[model samples]
Target chain A: MAYSDKVLDHYNNPRNVGNLDKKDPNVGTGLVGAPECGDVMKLQIKVNPETGVIEDAKFKTFGCGSAIASSSLATEMLKGKTVDEALQIKNTLIVNELSLPPVKIHCSVLAEDAIKAAITDYKAKSATPATAQTA
Target chain B: MDNHHNCWHCGTPDAGSIFCRYCNSLQAPVPNYFEFFGMPLKLSVDLARLQKQFYSLSGLLHPDRYTRRSEQEKRYSLEASSILNDAYRVLRDPIQRAEYVLKEAGFDIGEQRSKDVPPELLEEVFELNMALDELRMGDDEVLPQLDESRKKFLDILVEMDAGLEQQFQKHDAQEGDEARRAVLAEIRLTLNRRRYIKNLVNEVDKLLTARNA
Candidate 1:
């Protein structure tokens, strides 16, 4: 099925494509995959913990247009939002924003999952010491 | 999903005929991956067998055999090639294959609470998580200490994998329904832990990459 204009637009020209300083406590990296499709998405956020505001957002996704668009739009929406606000970003919103087709709906869902995963990763990282060597 | 018939070129012998039995030209198979593998619809599977079958099929029906075929025949070959790749990818990985099989069985592991990662794995998972966290935040001093734990984890996975293989062989050998069902349940759990540990290793690899970066 062909993606809509919006989906194609965001997909062909994705935004916020990069990684955050995952090692930096303030950076949250969300890495998640849909085992069904083998689609992986990594969403990152730079948040101001004291204020809970997401300062910068980025993503790297390997999947369909819907998947890429969903993540791009999710990060776009995350700019300046608090952690709670960003967490509240739903799959439907991403789907609606990207105009994803029904069959590709999971792409949007994965984007949402990636966001949560990033937040979780961020929180986990921040909760620990400033520098711990993991191998 | 495939449909089989006699090989149009040479109808000598045919089962799930995807080629002319005599000519061996490209054709469509009657059986799908699930049927070809003789597997139930579940998220977990016997991967080694799946790999073996995949190679077996590739040896026979790969598009290269149809290099001299008509345009329509080549199109069929291209589609078949892609499907083979897709099926192999889906069935080879424990997680992808498991989810697909679950859907085929009309079940959702994510929707069900009973399958929420075996509780037995909880302690191990927690310890791994805690250690990963500490390692991620710990100083370079911790690097020297991680080797033992990494080796231990690998050894455990290897042991479990071998045990699972034995169970799988027994299940496959079973001639009756009851024996098969029991083995299936055992495989399901073993596969889950295998998936979990695989993820942990990936996470460790990521942390290592991040450190190097």
Candidate 2:
């Protein structure tokens, strides 16, 4: 199937394609996979603790073009958004933006899941004062 | 066994068998693969018996044999022959058979998300992909690491197949619906993980072949 031009564009020049420090307490890493297609996506967000805003986002995806584009676009959407605002990010918005076909909708869903997972990890880390105190 | 229907040719009440007993006319074939094969709804299939049945049924349902027969019989033969091929192909392979059972049991096999996969497995998959990416980028140093990962994944596949065998037996041994559904759930999860690792192995194999070539 032909990919939408937007998908192709993002795939060719994936935005924020890198990794954040997983050991950093402020960085939230979301590692997820779509087993049906054997796609793995890692999305991370570094939050500003005081303002609770996501300051930086990065993603590295290993899969088809649509999957890579989905996660790449997801990281772009994650930056500058607060933790709660990031939680409100929907897969449908990505689908519309990417013009993803029905079969590739799951790729967008994977991106959305990655965002939620990252936020959850960040919240979990921040909730534990022991790690913050030690650091 | 509950698929009792009247024979189209003889109007005889048939017990869902392939052919009518009284007038010996071909009935509409059972759609369910297990029922069509006259096998119980179980995962542990007997290959020898299944093969014998396949050959016998293939002969019986050949369209050539129904040419001189009624048009209805000929059509039934054609339909039965098609379903027979599909049934045999799917039931012969253990993995396909398990997948068929899962689909029949109302499980959504195709729509799995990342949450379904265990976190540790995803981490391994991610690292393997990173190594693969390095190899793709002209980094020959990671080739040895790729080889090691490939071997590790292959070993995991072998171990997983053994585990699947046990799950199959467990599923077959369960008589209650609740117990059977529980086993089916486990089988589904195992199949998903197996599919992921299988893809990883295939990817590594392809890259290795390309490098060698």
Candidate 3:
């Protein structure tokens, strides 16, 4: 299928395609997959503990162009936003930005799921410092 | 929903019939995978019996037998042969049969790129991908990690299969739509997880093969 120019742009030059220090106290990691298509996406965010603002974001995805573009755009939009603000970024918005087709809509959903998973992991870690290391 | 078919030659209504007895012509709208073979809607099918039926039907539907017959009979033979082939192709395998049944029941078995990632495997999946990337980059140090991932993924698959068997038994025993729907949902989730693990194993195997080569 022909991808939109925006999707092609992101696919060719994906922003923040890497990993964060998952073990860091301030970093939250989100890993997600679509078992049907075998698409695995890893999105991570580093937040400033004192300010509760996202300081950095990165992603690594093994899937299609839409998934790659979605995660790339996700990291780009996530940086500098608060965790709550990042949570508010909908899959619909990603679809709009990427001009994703109906079939590729699930890629955006995976991106959204990845973001939520990362934030949840971060919250869980912050809530229990004692067990964080063991966890 | 409509299973009835009329023979093109004689217009005889053939309900659950492979061929029209009136005109001896092939009919359209073949029965579903299960019904075509006169088998019960169950997960575990007897392969030997299914195979025997397939061969018997194949022999009966062989186009060679219709060589001296009318054009209509030859066409019917070809159609019936195609239907028989499709039924055997899907029903012979346990997973394919389960998926076919689910599809027939109006359940979407999320296609590839399905966004339904099993919640528990997120973290492990992330790390596994990282290990895969390292292996692709010719990093020998991650070999052990890849092996560990393979083992873990295989364990999940085994667990999923066991869960599927139990769900299948429950589905067969249940008498109501509500109970059967619940069982179907469980089977869907287990099948989804199994697919992911299978993909992961294939990924690991690819890397290992390249390394050995």
TM-score of chain B of each: 0.63, 0.96, 0.85
Please identify which of the two predictions, 1 or 2, would achieve the higher TM-score against the true structure: 2
Comparing 2 and 3 by DockQ, which wins? Answer: 2
RMSD of each: 11.6, 2.5, 3.3
Instruction: Name the best candidate (by DockQ).
Output: 2
Candidate 3: which docking quality band?
Answer: medium
Model 2 chain A: ten consecutive residues of lowest lDDT: A126-135
Interface-residue RMSD per candidate? Answer: 7.7, 1.0, 2.8
- In the range B1-213, model 1's lDDT, one tens digit per residue, is 333455555565553445564565666543355754545544446678788888887766567877787876777777776777778888887556645544454444443111334434443444454466567786665565455556666887898778876865676677776666666666666665666666666766788788889
Please give the lDDT score at residue B38 for candidate 2: 93
lDDT of 2 by residue, A24-123 (tens): 9899999989999988999999999999999999999999999999999999998899999999999999999999999999999999999999999999
Q: Whose lDDT is greatest here?
A: 2
At residue A36, give the lDDT of candidate 3.
67
Q: What does DockQ give for each predicted structure?
A: 0.04, 0.78, 0.62
Q: Score chain B of candidate 3 by TM-score.
A: 0.85
Per-residue lDDT of candidate 3, residues A15-68 (tens digit): 998878888878999888887677888899999999889999999999999999
> What's the TM-score of chain A alone for every prediction?
0.91, 0.96, 0.96
Docking band of candidate 1: incorrect
Give the winner by TM-score. 2
Candidate 2 DockQ vs. native: 0.78
True-vs-predicted CA distance for residue A80, candidate 1, Å: 0.9
Instruction: Write down the lDDT that model 2 would get.
Output: 0.92
